[model samples]
Target: MSQPQGFDQRDDQSDRALRPKRLADFTGQVPVTRNLSLAIQAARQRKEQLDHVLLSGPPGLGKTTLAHIMAAEMGAEIRETAGPLIEKPGDLAGILSSLKQGAVLFIDEIHSLKRVVEEYLYSAMEDFRITIQLGEGATTQALTLTLPPFTLVGATTREGQLSAPFRSRFGIRERLDLYSPDELGRILARSATLLGVAADAPGLATIARRSRGTARYANNHLRRIRDLAQVSYGNRIDVAVANEGLAMLGVDAAGLTELDRRILGCLATHRRAVGLKTVAVTVGEDEATIEDIYEPFLIQSGYLVKTPTGRLLTVKAYQHLGLTPPEADENQQRLF
Candidate 1:
């Protein structure tokens, strides 16, 4: 199974091994990586710890991977955890206190942090210290613990949910975008070589086109195809083998999953803009999953459009289903 930014732990080992160890090895995300490279270089030139960084983007786009790459580039040990895991102030404090000087503390899904815990980070990020109350009522006393100078790297898909003060503290912030088809192809090629899978360009391209612009999906898709190839294609994955695997998995030529097609099918039936909740109910998916995971690619690939009202299937979506679409006029185009 694919790790989410994979906080689930079961997929950690392979996830880390497949991840790019250096900034140079990381693919796509040119603009973010460029600025980060300069920032890391400048910090290294000064012989100082890099500033706190916040990486915002959809899941599986390599925000956590970039954080790890940064730690490696800085030659620092990285401690990793998710925001919800660090519940109380003491939980946050303990992680901060245990860090060595110049360590990188990576917090994934940082937008999920409780307000109390987030507030505790302000001082730790700024003055490198945290203050905690040490007793009950009459005996209560505030005690401050100084933390080692370190970098805080946080990754989240919901950047808008972050508080203003919390967002302002990060010296470096970057949003990772979806990868292009060619970029995913390159990533899949590298992964195939690493896994000792014999795959041609067409095989990789076939899988890449179905990866929905996410590296995590690309890797996952490649591995599945490799397994299928081993069973029937003499361990060689060609375009035909790739397509057969994808067909079995229910991933279409356009990379739409069963859920994605369900969302589109809902739009087709609605024949008009529909709210996310409606689609979620129709497709048996959570509203957030529809908005975050499935919708972006549908919109990007021109199969769907988000109107002021809701989501509408584009002409391309209907055509993909082998059905004729209603006449789309200039008015509908403007709504897009």
Candidate 2:
């Protein structure tokens, strides 16, 4: 799909579904968007290239899309790769040496790079030069290759895992938060029109509320609902069709999936705040997976809350599950 300014070719259909062409098309992330705009404008006014950028966020939140936008804004060619794909330092060296002036090297999942490979990147990012060893002999000499000025756009889901040296190299650091329900609803409505799917406002609202503030999830649900409408009713998606499709997919009114229900069940039945580790153990999932994949949505929907002590169920959580609040817990009662 054609991206706005700074993106490369996308492989996933969902990426194309909500990919914003320019800064204006990208929804939500008001502060980050504003900051990026200023940075781009300042760079253009100086007639210099933009600095290297690092985007940290959960998956499916438009890191890749924004990278493409940055490239477009600069009118530069983008070369895409992942950190894990660069097995040796030479792999990254070759790609870096090939970059043209003002090119963008977009590296996804950048926290997974090996220490040696990461060391090589430090010099490349700072001075745009790669040192090569000629031979292991008495006459061995070091050859330094100076590269054209380029930008590195790195995306990572786990910012904490990146070493301070690597993180500090990025001139611009932006964090992406989950979108609001209203923002997601607009995204769904826009996508529906673009994809030629006929959906009413109510239908789009239903998809957005249940999307857990994720544009990718909203688009995915809309596609499923459209399929249901075509097969069960006609090829039109309205409120009734959206509700039926969501019900069949086992998504609750608040957009909690089966895993979310399981987490809430454990918290409510225990009648105490539970640690994330214990909750992950009980659910048979890793702590990182739970935090990165499931907890954001549950927390946003008011189905879960992280206290100083541990994870607690909110009043809305009990009501959604059709359960009475425990009488003895003062905090739970007060929350209601």
Candidate 3:
């Protein structure tokens, strides 16, 4: 059977096992975890539902994991849904009305919610109530339903897409940042223990350095490398084994993937600032994926820069690709 457009069977199965069940077990995003711990403690003390939370960051940086953690920490049952799935006000109402008291309603990609559906959420989030129309035209009647005092945990990769009015509804908002290699290494070490894989520090460090500063990427890379180690390396991973696995997966020492290089190559070909649409078309990726997934690491790694006009490759990118930067870019590089 074919999966849905954005669903990944591998993630569906593996993520649950690898995910940190409690906030205390989570590895990265220190600031976010810290704030959430305090909030959870306060809410528990008050014997009230936790405040609605908004978590925004690049995909695979553990927004979904954190949502589940929040639910676990609060000892609340969680109901999960995505923004695109709730297409209408009725759909939102149905999900909202079903929640038990002190439950957590996790909505992934919350910024993709429709304008009308988002508005319908205002009262539900604020007052734990919703008003719905019972009929059409002259027969229409407004019925307000009281919902359980559940905490709404919304996650988004693009927070700017949400309207100011919608954004303001959340009582708590936290933006997760990319993980440092050390943080990712710590996460990978824990994962190795859980997976029962024998891995050395250098081997895990090698994988962590190339994990694109995301714990999800680090864990995924560890799993793939573990397969290689099991079959070819006596169920043990060393630095050489990790390097071989990453090379087999087409990830470079710098952690850039084939698609990452293609995006860089596209920018290199243009030799000037290029618009996102042009890069997306050339790289065979959607604009959002490039912007949200690929571009962040590129910018963070000093391989690319975004100006008001467009994106421009840096001298580091040209060197990585074994190409020469234009003279103007060469002079600009000297300035830095």
Candidate 4:
């Protein structure tokens, strides 16, 4: 396949290069990090390399950062690639064969790899060998190439879609959970210091609460707020300036963006629970994006609930929208 432009390709290599040097710098996922640290230390003690690792999580949750950190700590050369980029088996073979000893091959979105390419990876990951067949005749022979003892770090957002056999190959498999408000606040403050932005306590807290507990969202909000502050007022970002910036961006104090409001509005106004399809259509977002990006935060914040019937707006959501809950809802709540 021809190379796709603007997919996993960005000009922010400098920012990417300085994400985190060690596992300690890569924040969040404490349990996974502790387990992985133990595994790495044990491998080092045994004078053997760590086994293949699989990180499953939503996007922007620091899978790539952790991969780089692992390579840095292991003192190995890192080769980065994505699943879609490796179209053919030869593409993977060439990359694997060129690796130096103990190199780290980080493949992001590993679930997208073609079946043929994935099959080749299974053998390479297990036995450090690749079999290439030559000629079409009955006398055709299979040539086996020995690969260096390297690590394959696969990151995927959809772990369920991965084939069972493929999923079983990784020695370490962990999921990155969504960050809490406190964790996101710390991340925002850290990134703010690095970006040379003076954010007060209230400003940081506001951004953190409004960031929906995602470090990427928090960082992006800070960037926008900083730009707004620089343009409208002085470069200093205080609570007032932050609130003004967020208001102009249509993000409320509760971290409910305009789209989020629309979703709740539909559910509240309809006076009944609605299916994901209906919610997506009303909000003008794809169902998958709603589930992956927006719904999780809303549900976690007590603004929405996934019922057996469908998506229901909670009393808090109704209050946020300046609406009152129905008597039936109140009675049902009391009975429950």
Candidate 5:
């Protein structure tokens, strides 16, 4: 995992406490909320289980929160697990067979599931049953298990890694996008109220703009700032305190963390399109972390661009890094 912006135990607890339990309470991802609301309403009216759902997005975009919200809206008990945890077909069979009628089975990082386990899930998702082979010898017998009518809510940061067959099994699919500053500001305001911290509009806005367009980061920053305010500012947050707290955390004005700048600085040094492997090695992070966590915000904020050849830093990236942009070469000028 990427070091900067990664959550810890306390942040996880805070996230759970601050997550909105109902669709109406959700702050951003308007289109996704609307689609889920319609599906939930229809499901409730028909007195049938909600269809399997696939929620895809970068981390901290509220995919897991939405899965919980969906279960809440459907009045279904939800069993949570990660894709890697269910290592064997028997493990999956046990969980599937144990769900109550109309429950929601939420799997985080669903794209990482082993292929055999994923194939084992196909039957349960389609027919509410799974076939398991008992005994691994000539005496083995096929045992088909009937499962309860439950919704499989899968959350994935790398949705493309999932097989086409697995992706198709989810009838209601939604992709969450990064939040706008205004939406993040609203979310922070609510979080402030919940956390019992007195915060000014400017303070919240400052934190929001520095949140990398993710609610989790906004709330995480709020909690940390709240700590600073409690000790030094009489439990009050203003722009100065917000900026001070964020700076202490190594978050710059553009919401770029130390790792983010390091990645950009690497690209700036190259002054050309650098492949993912090179960027990963130069930044001392794995390729997946750079691609999934850091690259999304950089690309979305117009700081970086992915080319057929490799990843290139844009003029905005150079400006953010306090460096001059280099003139493009003949073959690469078109990229600029």
Candidate 6:
């Protein structure tokens, strides 16, 4: 399914096991998890349907996992789909009508829905019904199908793209924040245990720091490192084993990937803040991807900064690249 740039793609039967099973098992977003738990309890006590939920955040922060957790916590069934898959009004209507009472209809990348389809969603969420017009000309008739009271759980990386009416229809909204390195280490440890891989704390911490504040990245690195350890060193992963394996993949000490290096190298050529388009042209990636996938981490890590004029490579970025930074203009010296 089409999603916002960089949404998690490894979601299958095998990969789904990597996700935390319940709200308690979820490792980060403490506030969000707590609030969701209370909301679920309140709804259950009242014997009412849980409010429609909106999970908005950058990709790979476990938004989909939370959607599933919501259904599990409420003891309600969940139907998973993406915005792009529901291309027509009938598609939305069919799914809505088929849902059992209090079921969760989870739609990932809700912002990608066509404007017309999105408009169709408003009534379904608000009134638990879909009004469809059948036939054309004089034979046309308006048919309103009453659906079971169901919760709509929408996940989006681009919250701004949703129309105001569509956005307001969701009764509960929560944003998932990036995980800290410490939280990521704990998650990595859990993943290693589940995968039956022998990983030490130091090794996990090393990978966590380089995980770009993402659990998916950390898990991928852990599997790769574990494979390397098994083949070359008897499956025991320590600090040395993790470092040596990751270094071979061009993941530097700061966890910057090859593309990150390329971006810094391209930006360094200008020696000044440069527009995103110029960076994309030089880096050979589209502007949308750079904005959605790359820039967030770069800015969060203090390796890059965005300003009104453009993006500037920070001193830390140059230092990580092992290059001397050029003299900065007095106006651009301070970090934003």
- Name the best candidate (by lDDT): 5
User: lDDT per residue, candidate 5, 1-336, as tens digits?
Assistant: 554564545577778889988888899899999999999999999999999999998888899889999999999999999998999988998898889999999999999999999998999999998887889889999998788799999999899999999999999999999999999999999999999999999999999999999888888989999999999999999999999999998899999999999999998898888899999899888999889888899899998998888888888888888898887662354444
The TM-score ranking, best first, is: 5, 3, 6, 1, 2, 4
| Candidate 6 structure quality by residue, lDDT tens digits, 29-115 | 999999899999999999998999999987778999999999999999999999889889889888888899999999998999998
The TM-score, computed over Cα atoms with residue i paired to residue i, of candidate 4 is 0.87
After superposing candidate 4 on the true structure, give the runs of residues whose Cα lies further than 4 Å from its correct spot: 1-18, 135-140, 326-336
Name the weakest run of 10 consecutive residues (lDDT summed) in model 1.
1-10
For model 2, the stretches where C-alpha displacement exceeds 4 angstroms are: 1-11, 137-140, 307-309, 327-336
Please estimate how well model 6 matches the true structure, expressed as its whole-model Cα lDDT: 0.85
lDDT tens digits by residue: candidate 1, 14-78: 76678998998898899999999999999989988999999998778899889999999999999
| Tens-digit lDDT track of model 3 for 241-334 | 9999999988898998888899999989988888999998997778998899888888999999988768988889999999988887453433
* RMSD after CA superposition, every candidate: 2.6, 4.7, 2.6, 4.0, 1.3, 2.3
Once superposed on the true structure, which residue ranges of model 3 sit more than 4 Å away at CA? 1-8, 329-336
Please identify model 5 stretches exceeding 4 Å from their true place.
none
- Residue-level lDDT of model 4, residues 1-336, one tens digit each, is 211111123424634643667987777789989988998888778767779999997666788888988888888889999999999998998899899988899999899999999999999999999988778799898999998889999999788879999999999999988888788777777777877878887888888888776666677777778888788877788889889888877789797778888989988877777899998888777787677667778887888888777888887888899998766554343210
* Structural RMSD, model 2: 4.7
Which pairs of residues clash in candidate 5, taking residues 3 or more apart in a chain or in different chains?
none
Cα lDDT, all candidates: 0.86, 0.83, 0.88, 0.81, 0.91, 0.85
Q: Is candidate 4 or candidate 6 better by TM-score?
A: 6
Between 3 and 6, whose lDDT is larger? 3
> Candidate 4: lDDT of 184?
79
The model with the greater lDDT, 2 or 6, is: 6
Select the stronger candidate by lDDT from 4 and 5: 5
Show pairs that collide, candidate 4.
Answer: none
